[model samples]
Target: MTSPLDSRQILRRQLRQARKNLSNHAQLIAAQTLVARVDHYLSGQQTDKLKKVALYLANDGEISPHLLCEYFWQQSIATYLPVIQGKQLGFARYTADSMWQENSYGIKEPVTADYAPSRDLDLVFLPLVGFDSQGGRLGMGGGFYDRTFANKRPDASPQLIGLAHECQQVKSLPVESWDVPLQAIITPQQSILVS
Candidate 1:
């Protein structure tokens, strides 16, 4: 009998491959489309109040945020990338001239000593393996984001958002107690604002 934990692991592998199967052209289109979707969401909110935003460097078929990073750069919003610190994540300012170092995961992180605590950022765009409409997020099984934002309230300073491709959404996800809910999930096609 497969336990929920085993089921979650199986689901993660399937979803990861599902995204990996996207053609390069399809991935590019999705990344471009995501910029517009996110832009539309920001239009309804108070933009001036949002100063810092943390984003991830795409890895293992995770939807790319590089284009969206450029869009934010144009708007003069400081972009940040997550740096692994012990068991959690720390945010470091990412810029055109930022130096890079690969973490254990082989993902590039800004090579800087300065880092802003997760709470100081205005927004955080998390990468996920799968997500459901009710704000549940299944991450890469590292537990980094969950531990980093464990204390974050539903309505906290740094609004947590998950970025993914349309194919990544599941009808329902097995939720774990340590899982942190997203305030919103943005895909190339649409945005799901969790209440």
Candidate 2:
């Protein structure tokens, strides 16, 4: 029998591999479809005050949000990428001409001194290894997003949304004490609003 922590680890590994197995063409289609789904979801919400938004560059098999970034750019909404600031995440504005530096994990981060804390952003789209319909998210086990947004509530200003491939959906996930609940989860096929 697997303990809850062990179960989570197993689920993480399985889901990570499931997504990682997607062909490059399939991944491209999923990303393109995601932009439409995300746009539709946001259109039905009150996004009048959205200014700064946070999203991640796709790593591993995480669905890319580059197209969604372009959608935001067209609307004049600034996008940011997470910078590893100690144990938590600091968001740096990402622009077409932004310079880059590699983080410890070899992920490229925007080379900028102007880092914004989580509270200032209007919306945040997170990358996940697995997610449940009830807003449970299994991250890369780094806990960066959890630590960065731990103090925020579901109805907080920076609405947390997890983005994933359809293959990453699970029946449920073991919720830990430190796990921060997402306000919603978005995939190429569906958008789940956590109530």
- lDDT (C-alpha, whole model) for all candidates: 0.91, 0.91
Error of 1 at 159 (Å): 0.4
lDDT of 1 by residue, 117-180 (tens): 8889998998989988877778999999999999999887799989999889899997889988
What TM-score would each prediction reach against the true structure? 0.98, 0.96
By TM-score, how accurate is candidate 2?
0.96
- Most TM-score-accurate candidate: 1
* Cα shift from native, residue 107, model 1 (Å): 1.1
| Weakest ten-residue segment in model 1 by summed lDDT | 111-120
